[model samples]
Target: MAVVAVSAGIMPDGYGSDRCWLNYDRGFIWSFLGPVCCILGINAVLFIIILILLRTALSQMQHGPAHDKLIKMVVFKTLVQSVIVGLPWILGFFTRSSQALDVVFHVLNSQQGTFIFLLHCVLNEEVRKQFRSCCRRMTNKE
Candidate 1:
């Protein structure tokens, strides 16, 4: 593979005439598609694990507002995590077929870090409480 890669170089050719990759034609299969498949597979396994854990936990918990809220929060967070992390990579597959999809992929891929930060911090209850505490302290000092 290394020898072939050295000979082929990273120049665009054949089907990938516009964009370059490790090889070009089949490079996407090995380089891009392989990793994407691994990531998606891992996500699928994790989601299954989460469902199993949730069922056990839910069965043990008593029915109440707190229990309901916990269920909603966990479900919502899991969904958001899946979409934010998975959607862009999924879109990447069809990006070559559609200009709009390509643009959407780029947008989502570029802001992945920001999206995660927002998910973990801005949307987090503990982070929100800390933010509120800091704001109150600053305002009281003034």
Candidate 2:
């Protein structure tokens, strides 16, 4: 799917035609929107699947203490992260390309990595312990 989208991007409608190709300059909609839409579509489908699985898990754990709260927290976090990561790109579709927008877009774009790392490691008890243990082991070795 990615290969197809990339191929489509590289060989857009105007490619190889001197009159319209313009030296392979990919237009905004083709280069950005196409891939962005494809990725967002894929993510949406995956999110639906995740919700289904989470629903099943919740149903199974209905009697367990605090499981419901944990499930809600997970869902809320997922939704918030999705909005944070996706909102800028979606808004970019409407806003014109400007320095301000570029800065905003890049900032939002770069935050995903940091956010994911913090979410998965810093806020996660198991990962935080493992990270600290690795740090201790390295220091001890040194």
Candidate 3:
């Protein structure tokens, strides 16, 4: 991606057009390469941050059955959350603004918001404890 950006004459000022792969006119190259490089750079940074977070979480879970379980749960939840949160953003990248906004609003105002709220409630220790205690008498379990 970086190669494409650089070769397409996308670099900032002081980076001459002579370095580009194709010898297109300066104005044409600038107009075509600008947005592509900008979007690619933003996506690269976001992915790097996510990778760092995952690596840190993995390093912290060194051993123990509970830690292993927690790691698995975290990985699963992260994957699900990524899909839920990123789907709209991904779609928006390829869509016109009006259509993207319509899709975003539909998802945000529907079951997606409710699912996020429920996940938040379930993950809270106090709520989980109360839920467990309430179910214990009914099932002889916790």
Q: Identify the leading candidate in terms of TM-score.
A: 1
Cα lDDT listed for each candidate? 0.79, 0.71, 0.61
The residue-by-residue lDDT of candidate 3 on 11-111, one tens digit each, is 34524456443334555454444665676567657766876797697877668887787777666666666556555545544433577576674675466
TM-score of 3: 0.45
After superposition, which runs of candidate 3 have C-alpha atoms over 4 Å from their true positions? 1-44, 93-105, 108-110, 123-126, 134-142
**Candidate 1 ranges beyond 4 A from true positions:** 1-17, 22-28
lDDT of 1 by residue, 1-142 (tens): 5534644465334224445433345454455566678889999899989988997998699999999988888888888888988999999888768999999999998998999899889989999999999999999999
Residue pairs with colliding backbones in model 2 are none
Q: TM-scores across all candidates?
A: 0.78, 0.62, 0.45
Residues 1-142, candidate 2: write the lDDT tens digits.
6755676676655434553222235462455466778888888898889888888887887565578668877887787778777877876665455768866777877787887777766777778899899999999998
Lowest-scoring 10 consecutive residues by lDDT in candidate 1? Answer: 14-23
Give candidate 2's TM-score.
Answer: 0.62
Which scores higher on lDDT, 1 or 3? 1
Candidate 2's displacement at residue 49, Å, is 2.5
lDDT of 2 at 88: 76
